[model samples]
Target: MNFYAIKAIYLFEMSRTFRTITQSLLAPVISTILYFVVFGSAIGSKIQTIEGISYGVFIVPGLVMLSVLMQSITNASFAIYFPKFIGTINELLSAPVSTLDIIIGYIGAAATKSFSIGILILLTAHLFVPLNIIHPFYMISFLLLTCFTFCLFGFIIGLWAKNFEQLNLVPMLIITPLVFLGGSFYSISMLPLFWQKLSMFNPVVYLISGFRWTFFNVSDFSFTISLIATISFATLCLIIIFYMFKTSYKIRT
Candidate 1:
């Protein structure tokens, strides 16, 4: 399975993360802490609770999901895009590793980083407000699933991008907005009925809802539906990536 080749690539990516520890790790953690300060401390003191859960506690899962999604995409996309930008991708391509091995290496490393950030954020949240994990198993399951899925999606972005601008385009313009509107800080049920219905079209809502459910046993959609939506999105990303790799899209050109 070319384990050595995969290990080399994996270690290289992980080492890069360590080298840029401030931007790669601390930045997201600090951002999340700020969110807790602004939203949890300032705003939460005014509002009593959302669905009987303290406003601060209610937002924990969403905040974690937000950070995880952004970091996973950023980490994976940059990891591969840098290679393409600097013309080192050809060297990796020339290596004996198969496509699956290469993907496992890069995506695995990115997911690990994002997963670590998610856990760190969760621990950080405990300092601000008490937390009760209704389903610990499901919580970890959702966190791992979200990390791997978004990392794969980011891998696709890396492959499709041609420049630095294009690499940052999707996560900044598209993903950030989705996470904000996806009930990260407030419940979708609190929205106007019309907006609530419209929010259903946003895929990020399902992810946040499902993750929040694991914490509070409450969600905008059924757990089964959220699970299905998440898997469906992951599958779609996989199909798109497969086509790109087969066509050598934005690569070997």
Candidate 2:
């Protein structure tokens, strides 16, 4: 692989993110605040604790995960889309860069953006509410892993998208709904037996469960199970992305 080419692509994409750093950082933070105010103050009283933590505290991981996931998808999608929009994707394909190099360059940029925003939101949360991360390493690791996995998923979305409207459809239509229903605001235990079982089908549930577990040292699913689910989704995303790049699905015509 051409290391120089990879760095060039990665650095260029990173610079693009910096151009809109204010928007990127603030948007998620603001949205997180809205969630906290509405859910924490208004509804938290009605709901009780999960795993010995307040409802507000329990939901933090899910909110953070939602932010990380959305940022990864949008950042990676834009990174891929800019080249197509500016007619540079053809040049990139013709360049000597390997597919792996291209994939890593874009995915790294996406993960970086997501990580930055995730940390910023956490910092913001500290001001309005207190949080505890019992196992710091596990917390950071899971967050980073989720960012990487979703970054790859974003690349696939970028490759599949032909226009700007199509670009946001997946994140808005599919991912957003999944996050809301993924037990971000409420624990699965609060659901009826049937809905509790049904909630298991949503992948984001595992992500939240694992993240919250790191905070309080308690989780609905075992940490091992959560890690396996994350790895599984990531592997599936990698395979799909590889196939898309190999065929140049919407990338090359």
Best by lDDT: 1
Task: Return the TM-score for candidate 1, rounded to 2 decimals.
Answer: 0.97
lDDT of 1 by residue, 1-253 (tens): 8999889999999999899888877787788889999999999899999999999999999999999999999999998999998889999878887777878899899999999999999989988889999989999998998998999999999998878899999999999999999999999999999999989999999999999999999998998898889888888887887788778888766
Tens digits of per-residue lDDT for model 2 on 152-182? 8888888888899999999999999999999
Candidate 2: the clashing residue pairs are: none
TM-score to true structure, per model = 0.97, 0.96
Superposition error at 67 for model 2 (Å): 0.7
Give the Cα lDDT of each candidate: 0.91, 0.88
Quick one: RMSD of model 1? 1.0
**Backbone collision count in every prediction?**
0, 0
